[model samples]
Target: MSETVTLPRPDDWHLHLRDGAMLTAVAPESARHFGRAIIMPNLVPPVVTGADAAAYRDRIMAALPAGSRFTPLMTLYLTEETDPADVVAAHESGLVTAVKLYPAGATTNSASGVRDFTRVHGVLEAMAEAGVPLCVHGEVTDPEIDIFDREAVFIERVLDPIRHATPGLRVVMEHITTQDGVAYVREGGPDIAGTITAHHLVINRNHLLVGGIRPHYYCLPVAKREAHRLALRAAATGDCDRFFLGTDSAPHPDGAKESACGCAGCFTAPNALSIVAQVFEQEGALDRLEAFVSRNGPAFYGLPVNEDTLTLARQDAPVAYPDRIDAGGEDVTVFDPGFPLHWQVT
Candidate 1:
């Protein structure tokens, strides 16, 4: 006998659909599972302006398979020189859903990110007034801070102060990987929420470092200790609207990931739904799956839950996922949850 759960088609609140060939290859994977996604804008040059977001959205639409209803909710990449009026105007026109903040040198293609938050003060104020949410890659790039402590330090040194000063600014702490992150979002009142990645809920630092380096498990705001992973699971599976799903389903080609200096990302787009469903079930909170994946995100973003539905069934046997997906010629590795996956979206 099999148990099944049907929910509104989910959204990926934080997703990376990289441009050109990579975009064309991976956009369909996300579209196949999610009804809408707040697409990341950290392209090489970055999508900094309204025009850039529009053009990128057009490209994403063109890349999707015909008749697919995948809506790419676009975003602007924040920089020190970003204009407040431009940010508010884009949100008002519905040209972009949010503005992304990737602190300088924080992650892939983030060299153009902000080092001086003070420079973007007016823009943050304008966003607050206009109800424009800011999706942040919540890690500090300070060289002195230990890599594992960046997220907590960032919250203490940067995130809290910013939120205090910029009241009413709706902030989504994207791919939060710490207990501190969970606690902050839970206590930060209505204006702040956190996105927990499928990978984070499933993997920890051990999965990345134990028994040799697993490059595919490496991601920005990299997975933390098992305790942190447990907190994320509890947060995602509990009754908390402040936490939602954002696979951060970043795809890097095989060569780039398997390099002398490998890139940090996990291409989990292909199996995100299945992985998430299994995690929810294991935690004995399958009842909360709909809210975490489908309902909570739209509520936070001031959008409606998707009318369409996705069905997931628990099977007696493990569901097989491909080891790699081809991008042009190179293969992008799919995330393996380290445990058998029984629940699959149909």
Candidate 2:
């Protein structure tokens, strides 16, 4: 017989609540499903300082619709010039939970990403001392390696070394997309943890190529083969304490997606939790869902688990995706948009 489980409310360890009108439009979807979220700092200009993080958090808070009890856990975007003192200041002010490291040119709005690992060693060392986490978009931005293999390469070439260099520093490999990434994070000891996105567990590379180029299926550290997807499901649902949920649910307007050069991201926030629940059920690990979504993230981040409670029932539901936000004429499609979701959040 299956057991019914009720657990502490979950937090999105990684999320992209873009600023401005998009922030107003998309913040509610995430807030409705999560008690708190670690908001991504990769905006157009990026949130590189503590003040920027605090201001962005206020914007996210304002965007949240009425009656929504969502807390935005902001992060600072790390750059080569990022002062180590700022890392300590941000943590001390309680404005940011972690410092996001996007290797230069790795993803959207990542132009200001750290140029070299050594450049930010000071910041990393400071985070180690402060007990703060360093959230990484773990993909090497080298031209030689095939796009699909960047995450795997980064694990061996960059992340491993960084881990060795900073012994006690806590690191979260955000939106892990490959089996190699999964294994590296799992075996790399307790100081290293990973955040798994909802889409990677449910969709594979074929989904993007099938039936023409599905732009909505596009995202950084792009989806991998079905075998990798299966591996991810196993790792996330498995007893590994290193894996947790981070729905890099980015919203791009339909226009940006339909252009000659399309942006890469999936607006999974609208249906993120349901997708995870469905994947867990399919993997025969539904009983472990609570830990993956709730306990593990906070435990890894050294934060108190929320007191709120949320329920996911095995029921059919539909999720809708708007072509664009009401405030702007932006154009892009969200992942799993307008689909019949198999799980419902209550």
Candidate 3:
């Protein structure tokens, strides 16, 4: 016998649909499962203004699969030179949903990110006044900080101070990977929330380095210790509304990922929901999956829950998913969870 579960259509609070051919190829994978996605703004040159966000949004809409109802919630990249007025206008015009802050040199395509947070005071203040959420890449790039310590260090040195200085400023800590991050969000008020990626809940650092270096499993604010992974799993499965789903399903071509210094990301968009279902089931929290994927994120962003629905059925046989997604001529490897998945979107 097969078992099936249905819930309101879900949304991805954090996603990276790169531009051009890559965008064209990968957009459909997300569209098939999610009703909306908070599209990242870290493209080449970055989307830094209302105008840039609008143009990028147009391109995303153009690339969406025909007849698909997938909406791309656009964001602006926060830079030292970013204009507060432009951000306000963008939000007012509904051209952008939030502003993204990538600490300079923190992750891929972040060369244009904010180097000195103090320089963007006015912009942050304006976003607060206008009620625009700031989605952050919560890791510091200081050479002295151990790579595993960046997220915790960022919370101490950067996140807390900014939230204190700018009251009422909504912030979403994107793709949190540590127990410190989960604890902070659990203690914070509604103005702050954290996004837990599908990959983070299933894998730990050992999966990336135990026997050999696995580039496909690598991502920024890279996976942490087993204890941290267990903490993340708990946060996502618990009844905490502060934590929600954000696949951070960034895709990099096989060539780019297999190189000596490969890019950092996991292309999990294709099977995010399926993998998430398996995790929730493993945790005996199937009843809470809808809140993590659909309800909490919409509440945080002040958006309406999707009216549609998605059904996942558990089969006797293992589920099968494509190993890679074609990005123009190159292939972007899909994240492999190393365990058989039995849930499939029906």
How do the residues 96-185 of candidate 2 rate in per-residue lDDT, one tens digit apiece? 799999999999999999887898898898899998899999999999999989999998898889988998998999999888988888
Best-first order by lDDT: 3, 1, 2
Candidate 2, which ten residues in sequence have the lowest lDDT sum?
Answer: 316-325
lDDT of each: 0.93, 0.85, 0.94
Q: Kindly report the root-mean-square deviation of model 3 from the true structure over all alpha carbons.
A: 1.0
Best by lDDT: 3
Clashing pairs in 2: 253-331, 253-332, 254-331, 254-332, 255-331
TM-score of each: 0.99, 0.95, 0.99
Candidate 3 lDDT (Cα, 0 to 1): 0.94
Query: What ranges in model 3 sit over 4 Å off?
Result: none
Ranking 2 against 3 by lDDT, winner:
3
Give the per-residue lDDT of model 1 (tens digit) for 119-168: 98899999999999999999999999999999999999989999999999
Pairs with backbone N, CA or C atoms under 3 Å apart (clashes), candidate 1: none
Model 1's C-alpha root-mean-square deviation from the true structure amounts to 0.9
